[model samples]
Target: MSKKIYSVICGTGKYIPTNIISNEVFLNNHFTDNSGKTFSQSNIEIIEKFEQITTINQRRFADDNLTTSDLGWLAAEDALNSSGIERESLDYIIFAQNFGELRHGNTGVDILPSLAARVKKKLNIVNPNTVAYDLLFGCPGWLQAMIQADYYIKSGEAHNVLVIGADILSRISDPHDRDSMIYADGAGATLLTSQTSNTPTGILTHKTRSDTLEYSEMLFMGDSYLPENGTKKGIYLKMHGRKLYQYALKHVPGAIQDCLNKSGVLLSDIKKVLIHQANGKMDDAILNRLYKLEGDLSVPFDVMPMTISWLGNSSVATIPTLLDLILKNELDGHKIKKGDKIIFASVGAGMNINAMIYQV
Candidate 1:
């Protein structure tokens, strides 16, 4: 048979918690360092530089009482409802999270199954092979999960696939570290299936690449980084900012060009570029090369403000979160018409990069 096409038929929902943390609020709240002085006072120049360079304004954090799975459940329901893809129609659910219930027996082992059970119980679709385990690889998990689902749908092993990306940044961020401020808690979902009709714009081709050589560039660790004070503190994320930036600026565009070339699509053919909101600098560099923009591509400079300043860095959730925001707000009453080509590119902690080109 000819190759099958996997269409992202509909994206129904996004779930962000009630509580939001703004940059000003976080700075005041976390002002005091381990030393007596506030961070700005102690490291005046560094804080000032970070303020100018970073653009995230705010990010939502799950209540201390809630877990990553809770966020996932809400997002899952929203996605299923939004797509109108009945629970009975879903054959697989893949949950991706770099930070989830760690105190539990296993990290992501139970996360996927438990979330799957929630849908099964509600929709009453109880089948054995219908579910599979969870997977993790830092921020790239969303695209990685989508690529896997594409394979399953193409091979006819499944009909409907729900790939959810969820995370709790507060759990992974060191309260004392300034970098931690960039992270926020949230979830987004995409429904993937085999496209049998011309009306559906399915994923034409998929490719993912990772350079494990710099595996240690970003990571999380156990109590070694902190003392377990009976509080819920566990692992925290670590990153080499400059080094990672160098690698991403060099590699991500190349990966994107490769994907587009394989699909025989030219750069001019692309419409909206839904890039992973890694950072203003990195994203700017990549998008500039792709569109051949002289300076900034003028691609909604307003959107990255919160992404840069407040929300800190939401590894895998950034792309889908941006997608949700764009669909809800920016794409209205203006540009981004139908049949336009859009590209979703991502670069994350695992030193992983994904560049997917799609039509609107």
Candidate 2:
């Protein structure tokens, strides 16, 4: 048997902001319909219902002084330091984010310099060949970047890569929209390096699905719900919450199954399902449906680790952040040992859904 080169996660790190925003922050938001019509329910009632649905009490927000690139740099530095690999040896730096860097109080594209480029500059890598680029696949961006890194390794185009998932939804969310409560700011990163081994380890098999024709606008930017909040020209992250939820329920589980089938890995062998923390109720339903498909009604308590309850949904950052936490033993009762098979899956803005199975 010949050895094959695979992309293995060599290091992991994350940056969770110190500023905590709680549900109370939205208690006085005066949320309204798309036409600026005020809600009939009181803020208290709305928050209660939100908590019941999303199980999110609070989330982090980068300090007003920080930018999305700053968060990415922090996470990248942590991952780089942990890997103990020379910075000049990195072949690529992939920064996964959606709305560029729209800092607090300044709602601008700020995309002149890609976040990856900015992060690379911050890292001060003198190597001109360490190609830096940004990706915009919405919440699944980070996972997608990892998949790309795997390709680079398997194809022998690259050896070491820095994949960073960082986003600051706080700056892009419409303050008048209740959905804003589900958005958060955080960054997480992983270092993937090429390795040759006879055993099936690291990244094994992966699958991705995109349903844009019908669900293209399921999650997109639009004018604020409350017209009085700002100029009509200003836009923010908006979503057809119900439609998106339905789409995830209909497709995400199947996508997971596709990756499982591709890898020939049984559901019983996967010790962890590090799924995107979009919404608590939605995640619960997705996992339940997935387990049910395996003829098992009970989902093992540790099978799916989550951070949405306190971290909210930081778009691309969710999965990597959750993985970093568990691997570092920061998420209580969750730990992955050598040879543990885990699955990473996500569904987000592109109406994109993906799943990957990895052995650690």
Candidate 3:
């Protein structure tokens, strides 16, 4: 029998815009409420409360000249350069994002010329056979794309694939809404290549599930009316924070446990848990519960590295960017060594939750 094929992450890259929006800036600006009236003292109090809840001090936003595809392209280029892989040799490109390109001051997304296709053109790759497509699995999108690429490599259908997760959520956010502080813009990319290996490597196992029937409405983006504006339509993201927090607390731990069991990896062997940078508090709670499932009441503080305080929640871009930072030794107290086991988990829109086991 031929040697077993496995997919291995060859390189990683990330792109964060230069524009910074701090909490102080939000405080200085006047914002209109849903009723078209300026926010009162009580509404202004929400900013401080938001900082306490999310621990997000600031976030990056793309420049007016850039689009979501542009961010993804810059990240993809860096990933390719790090991997030393020829662009023409890539067999596939899987790009993930919830909102496509957004016009300044516009809440609608541009759907034509898919982001994946745009990245392909930006890279100037001449291979017509290289397949490219966009994935929409919410925040778990990048991990989902990596899982799909693993199958393609294992099936001998592809040698290498580039996976990207990017979003310009600021473009779609309502500046008047306090929740907009949690959304940012950024992109991350990873290159996975197939290789023959006798021992297990790369993605060992994964689990993805969605609770659309019960929790889909818990978080969404849709039209919101401004009182005096007379039926204005803006697709702004909305979330029932408390309900979603409860949902995550109930389900995320179980999902991590299932992934570990499926991969035959012990909790003690995992060097790090790269979770989605959604809410710092929620993420800590989930990790606390997850460690408890392993029969340990004491939680390892450094086992998970967080970027939400600086990067905010860029949806799908969270995990890959965190991974890139850790891999490059940019994140303090977090580093991955060869043969170390890592677990990735995320929860986001679609009420979707997923976990994956990977070996470095």
Best by lDDT: 2
Query: Clashing pairs in model 2?
Result: 339-360
Q: Give the alpha carbon lDDT tens digit for every residue of 169-223 in model 2.
A: 9988888888789999999999999999988889999999889899999998888
lDDT of 2: 0.91
Order of models, best TM-score first: 2, 3, 1
Clash number for each model: 15, 1, 0
RMSD of 1: 4.3
- Across 246-271, the per-residue lDDT of candidate 1 in tens digits comes to 88888887888888887776666666
lDDT of 3 by residue, 275-330 (tens): 99989999999998999899975776688999999889998899999999998899
Candidate 2 positional error at 60, Å? 0.8
Please estimate how well model 1 matches the true structure, expressed as its whole-model Cα lDDT: 0.65
Candidate 1: TM-score?
0.82
- TM-scores of all candidate predictions against the true structure: 0.82, 0.98, 0.94
Off by over 4 Å in 1: 1-4, 28-48, 102-125, 198-200, 222-234, 292-310, 329-336
Rate residue 195 of model 3 by lDDT: 82
Lowest summed lDDT window (length 10), candidate 1? 101-110
Which lDDT value does model 3 have at 27? 74
